[model samples]
Target: MTPRELIDVADVPGGPPLRLFRRGGDFMIVLERNELMSTRMHGSEVALGTMACDRLAGRPAAHLLIGGYGMGFTLRAVLGRLGADARVTVVELVPGIIAWARGPMAAVTDGCLDDPRVTVEMGDVAATIGRATATFDAILLDVDNGPDGLTRPANNGLYGNQGLADARKALRPGGVLAVWSASSDPAFARQLQRAGFAVETVRVRARENGKGAMHVIWFATKR
Candidate 1:
């Protein structure tokens, strides 16, 4: 068995610090004992971007707001589906996450961050959403384990009623809000409905080979 090697640690404001670990060739970003993300199991993360772009097929110049740049999996997936005219704004709360991308994880990053259509913002995604009004064609969120804010206590607002409402207001008519989760949450689906969105909950496998743990993604469209 290969031993896991610690690469570096990053501090998260209001939450626990994140640790980067490597075992063999695979990398993992762990929050305490809970592994937040891994390079090995990213099929669902890729799907989050691919499926959301599928919904916006007709729009060539769509502006997308992606929350959290976890290992750049979703960002790369989104960039693959979008055209030259399309724009993507990625907002990340933790500065070290970006540093890891450009530093130790550069090989895995594959120059996605340097893409012309992408804009990197170091800030809270909720604040970015609040500042906009019908500005985005889609909003992709993979900020926490799920909607209940396992990463940080403040993240709970992003999944609550007001946060959903704010998200609705931030999107253009018929825009999609894509959220990724490690597991399922039935109540959150209903909450999306109550927030006046047409919600679709999808289950996807963690690995690209279509074998691994199951994950959930909620694609909520503004009504």
Candidate 2:
């Protein structure tokens, strides 16, 4: 097998630099030796969007806020589940990831950024949630690995007490806040429940063919 070639690198706030690699026709973004997201395994990423958007399908206008834009899989999937009147606000912290989306991974993005219902913001996902008040029908969080903050120590706040409260405050009544995790965290689930959400834990397959490792997604609906 041929070795993966490193394409570029970018520094991330409160974390190490992100490394981009290419192998054959696929791409991967990694932190140190740990692979973050890949072009190959995307089933769970798509599920992250579908699970959140499906719950918001019946809502009018369907204002959605996506915390991260990893390869644009979740963003694209959410757009597919939403209607013409729906609006998706994607906040990607890393500017290089956005550049990579339009450059090396343009095919993976598939013009989701160009959609009329989409608005892109380059800033901290946490900051966006902090200021928003009952503004979103669904908030899809696919940043870091989960509540533990594998990518950045600051990411832990997204699953922390004040952070969870902020996320809840940003959601409308009956709105859903979905979080993607590489593994299960019982404590995180409990946090969601304590934050006034009806928690539903879902175990999803990582690969599209249902053959890879299982991942966890928590759907926390505002009460």
Candidate 3:
């Protein structure tokens, strides 16, 4: 077996530091004992982007907001599907994650951050969402493990009732709010309904080849 090599550590405000690891060609971003993301298992993340874009099929010049640029999988998937007129804004809290993308993991990043259609914001995604109103066609969130904020306790607010309201307010009419989770949460799905969204929960495989652990994604369209 190839040994895992320690790459770098990134500090997260209001949360524990994240560690990057490399094993041969694969890269992993881990938080304490839990692996937050990996280059090896990004199918669900890609689906988060592609599936959301599918819901917005007729909008060629759509504007989208992405929370957390994990391995750039979701962003790349979105870039592949959207037209040149489309716009994507990505908000990431940890600086080192971007550094690693431009630095050691450049190949995996595939220069997605430098795409002309994309904008990189260095801050909490919640702030960005709060500042916008009927601005985006879609908002995709893959920040924490599920909705409970495994990375940062403050992130928990992004899944709370107020957060759902803010997200709804930030999107254009019929815009989608796509959330990726490691597992399903019935309560959260119901909360989406209560927040006045037409929700659809999907189970997707972690690996691109249709194998590996099953992950959950919720597509909640604004009413």
lDDT leaderboard ranking: 3, 1, 2
Could you give candidate 3's per-residue lDDT for residues 81-178 as a string of tens digits? 99999999999999998999999999999889999999999999999999999999999999998988888999999999999999999999999999
**Model 2: per-residue lDDT, tens digit, 68-148?**
898999999988988899999999888899999999888888999999999999989999999999999999999888777
Clashes of 1: 0
Task: Encode model 1's per-residue lDDT on 138-200: one tens digit a residue.
Answer: 999999999988888999999998999999999999999999999999999999999999999
Off by over 4 Å in 1: none
Report lDDT per candidate: 0.95, 0.92, 0.96
Error of 3 at 102 (Å): 0.2
Clashes of each: 0, 0, 0
Winner on lDDT (1 vs 2): 1
lDDT of 2: 0.92
